[model samples]
Target: MTGSLTIGTLAKQAAVNVETIRFYQRRRLLDEPDKPPGGIRRYTQTHARRIRFIKEAQKLGFGLDEVADLLALEDGRHCREVEEIAGHKLAVVRERMTQLSKIEKLLVVLVGRCHGNSGKVRCPLIASLESATA
Candidate 1:
């Protein structure tokens, strides 16, 4: 918030846990400041901003490794590289969405079959699942 902050303060500012800050430091996503003799390590608003950036990227389905790549290209000179990475992620998301849509259609059909059953035989949903495994 102010000029300098501790790790806890930085995590609070970034809306993450203190351990998350340390993990980021270990992951090389955030820089760990040197501690003075008998004193605590200080963090800056810049560190908080970096954590927020990592979090936002993750919320958009970027893994930590991908976030690391994005961070490496944060300098404005690498827009093309960033765009390529983002385009790839978008393609993955689109494919996953297509798969999910197919799953949803199958679920709808299975539930419909279950509803139409007269309760005189085995459950349609269960039979469908068994057949799938078979």
Candidate 2:
């Protein structure tokens, strides 16, 4: 924890797989430390922090592309830009919630219909899905 961390240690500390770290490196989301001739590459606490930041951002519904934008605006001076990005993400989350709620309601009705059936008959859920528009 005091000295530089190897890639495996960094991955463990960052709660991500080694492949994920490489993916982030390829995406330019994380910096790839220089390799010393025959020496292994090592990461710093800063890199660990950045990985955590990326993961947290993704948990809040930001995709990698959006996470990149968030990373770019991470500097304290970009408060307004960050807000704009967050505002957009909020709108997307709200819309997804609305869609999910609608789907939940439909599933409840369809499941209830199927559950209430006492005899062997056609499934209401299948019928509904077949008749569903769009």
Candidate 3:
């Protein structure tokens, strides 16, 4: 707290790995702080917060590019644009859910056919995948 924090300190506070912070820097999602003369660069709490925000956004299925747009909206001038972006993301989520449900149904049927008494030569899971492609 006396001086600015180092990358390790920022990573610890953000609850992420040091390499993750570096990756964010490389991706331009987080800014690299300037190093002082004969000293290492230090990150402020804002950097830690931004890293947390990016991680949380990713957990919610937002890609890095979308997270960057969300960060822009956090700048207080793009409040109105957030809704449009979120709506599009919701539509995408719904589509993925539909696709996942279809996959789940197929997996259920495939698993049901595996009576566990058959030899490995007749594996239903492999059969299902092969048939789908054919």
Candidate 4:
């Protein structure tokens, strides 16, 4: 909020770990500034906002690549294009939710079958996975 922030301050303001900020820099999601003479790299309020944006996007299930595209579209010129991307992401999310629901149901069934069983048999979860692979 004052001058540029150090990495630790930025991470604290963004409510993220320092390593997460470093990871984002390595992944090219966040910009790394040039270090001054004998000083470490400094981050700005913009960098903290960007880190928060990336975390929120990820929490919503957007992949880093998709988040990058979303970030690129934040300039207001690409509103329509951003809408299209969001729509596609929504469809993908729905499909994944459906698949996960099915898996959850199967897991519930498997747990029920395992209750009170004393035999040293193979895990139902592993068996189900193997059968699906086949």
Candidate 5:
């Protein structure tokens, strides 16, 4: 590769779309290269790496704000800070899983009731939902 690449090449190398790169630039998460007189701007490997980092962080459930925070600490000097973020995310995921488990159990009970019924004109699931709001 050359010293720098065009936005399209950077996007291709980063496995992201051009619009995503533009959006990141608009969000101040990425730096937009200066366009020379009648010439296209170019991106460097640093830019590509930043895009990949943001994408990977997002995949791990980090929001844009969180990703920016992580990016600011990307100098590889804040292990403890990174761990703190990961810990909080893990806690949130665990709480969500617990809630989902309860919901799953409730759904199973409702579906089982529906399957076992032969006489009741009122659906137990519907009745439960309607009564809960009333």
Candidate 6:
């Protein structure tokens, strides 16, 4: 490989579309190579790898902004800072899980009530939602 990959080829190597690469460039998450006079911009395997890194981070629930931060610290000299970011993300995930669990429990109880009171004039789930909002 001659490090002369076109954007389309780079996207293919990274398993993303060309527009995804463009969007990352727009967000400053990826660099936009300069095109020479009357020539096209090119990409390389490094660019593809960077796109993969962004995609994997997203898979682990990091937002684009967080990904940008991680990218900024990618020189391997910011381990502690990286850990702090990961720790904060873990805490947020835990809190969200706790909230979802409570919602699940409430839904279970409401669903059971609805089943038990089938054919009633009002649905227990609907009543619960209306009262909660009120």
Candidate 3 TM-score to native: 0.57
In candidate 2, what are the lDDT values of residues 49-131, reduced to their tens digit? 99999999788777899889777766444667778877887788887676666667778775777786786544344444444
lDDT tens per residue, model 3, 10-93: 888899999999898898888888768898888898898899899888986889998887776666555457688767777877
| lDDT (0 to 1) per candidate | 0.80, 0.81, 0.77, 0.81, 0.80, 0.81
**Candidate 6 lDDT:** 0.81
Model 5 misplaced stretches (Cα beyond 4 Å): 75-134
Candidate 1 colliding pairs: none
Q: Per-candidate TM vs. native?
A: 0.59, 0.59, 0.57, 0.57, 0.56, 0.59
Candidate 3 off by > 4 Å: 76-134
RMSD of 3: 5.6
Worst 10 residues of 4 by lDDT: 121-130
Residue 112 error for model 4, in Å? 27
Q: Which 10 residues in a row give candidate 6 its minimum summed lDDT?
A: 121-130
Worst 10 residues of 5 by lDDT: 122-131
Cα error, candidate 5, residue 91 (Å): 8.4
Give the per-residue lDDT digits (tens) of candidate 1, residues 1-134: 39799988888999999998999999999888998989999999888899999998898677999888777777444678778876886777886566566666668876777786776443344554444346
CA lDDT, candidate 5, residue 64: 99
Instruction: Provide C-alpha RMSD values for all models, in order.
Output: 6.2, 5.1, 5.6, 5.1, 6.9, 6.2
Model 6 segments beyond 4 Å from truth? Answer: 75-134
